[model samples]
Every structure is written in C-alpha cells, then in structure tokens.
Target: MNLKDEKILSAWEEKQSITGVHKITGYNWQQIAKVLSTYGIVANDTHEIILNLYDRGKNAKEISKITGYAETTVHAYLPRVRPAYNENISENAKRIKKYRQNK
Candidate 1:
C-alpha cells in the first residue's frame, strides 16, 4: 500500500475515486483504503466526488455519466455543491463571448 506506486498516485492526483483506481489498477478496496489511510488521502464520498468532477470542469451530464447519477440529480446537487453557481447557460455564453471578443 505504498503511495509511491506511480499508477495509484497518478490516479489519486487525477481525483479518481477508490473504485476507479481499483478498476484501473486491479487493486481491491482494502488495499486502496490502506494506501489512502497511509497517505492521509481521505477517500472521497459520492457527493465529494461529484463536486470534484464538477470543479474539474465536468458538466452535470458528464458527471451523471461518470457517476451513474441521473442528470437531474446532478443538476440538483450542483448549486448546493458550489455557491454562486450560475444555472443560466445563456449568461455563461454571453460572458464567454464577451471575454473572447475582448481577447
């Protein structure tokens, strides 16, 4: 259960969940949990993983696909996940347009 294992460390840095790391590395949950504990990397729960994925620029739909949550559920959690979440797609578009124009 060494954090020095490059494959595991890379997955952790990518914010992959324990299950994801397991899938990638063929490690069981216990081994992954041990590594997590040894390295003080708190295992991310579902809610936190969703937020982390969002923070990494995944949209609700994408998060839904990754997490097996419905799109509506992802949408429902998003605002609570981050304060000042702009649900207005058009507003974001306008801001992006303006920024690009200025640039």
Candidate 2:
C-alpha cells in the first residue's frame, strides 16, 4: 500500500476503536477494518493490546509503561505476537530509511 493507506492503517491501529479511527480519517470504520483484514490485522481485541501496541511502534519499555506489564514480560509476549517484534522493528527501520531517502 502507499503511504496514505499506511497512514490510515496506522491511525486505525493507534486508535484501536472504530469510531476513533473514523473520526480522524473520515472513512467508514468498516472499510478501514476490511483493509485491516487484508493485512491479517484484527483490530480491537483487548487481549491483544500488547501485540497491537507493539505493532503500532511501541517498544517493550513503552508498552510496559502503558500496560503496566513488566518490560521482560512484554519481551516474552513479543515473540508470540504476529510478525514478531524484531521483524516489525526491522520493517519499521526499512520504512524509515526509505522515507528518509525520499525526503
């Protein structure tokens, strides 16, 4: 997907609520959710908050602060989450590198 679509997905993931995402993106939440389905992302599962936060760019320390989970516990859960935390981090790094190159 292009940057705009990525941003929309990012916003959706960050908000973690259909209405919240819809309000910001001005797109129907269902449509946004459909896009998420295509990406294998299932939004708004409370049990997945840690994983979701990780996907939205929160590190173990950050997630720990937000979720009251210990940093080590967050680290433990990272591997169980889809895409793996390290892989997600690498992908983010690549995105940032490409973005910088474009700039």
Compare the candidates by TM-score and give the number of the best one.
2
Clashes of each: 0, 0
Model 1, which residues run further than 4 Å from truth?
Answer: 1-4, 45-103
TM-score of each: 0.37, 0.38
Expressed as tens digits, the lDDT of each residue in 8-38 for candidate 2 is 6888768876677778888775456555554
What pairs collide in candidate 1? none
By summed lDDT, which 10 consecutive residues of candidate 2 come out lowest? Answer: 79-88
Which one is best on lDDT? 2
CA displacement after TM-score superposition, residue 49 of candidate 1 (Å): 17
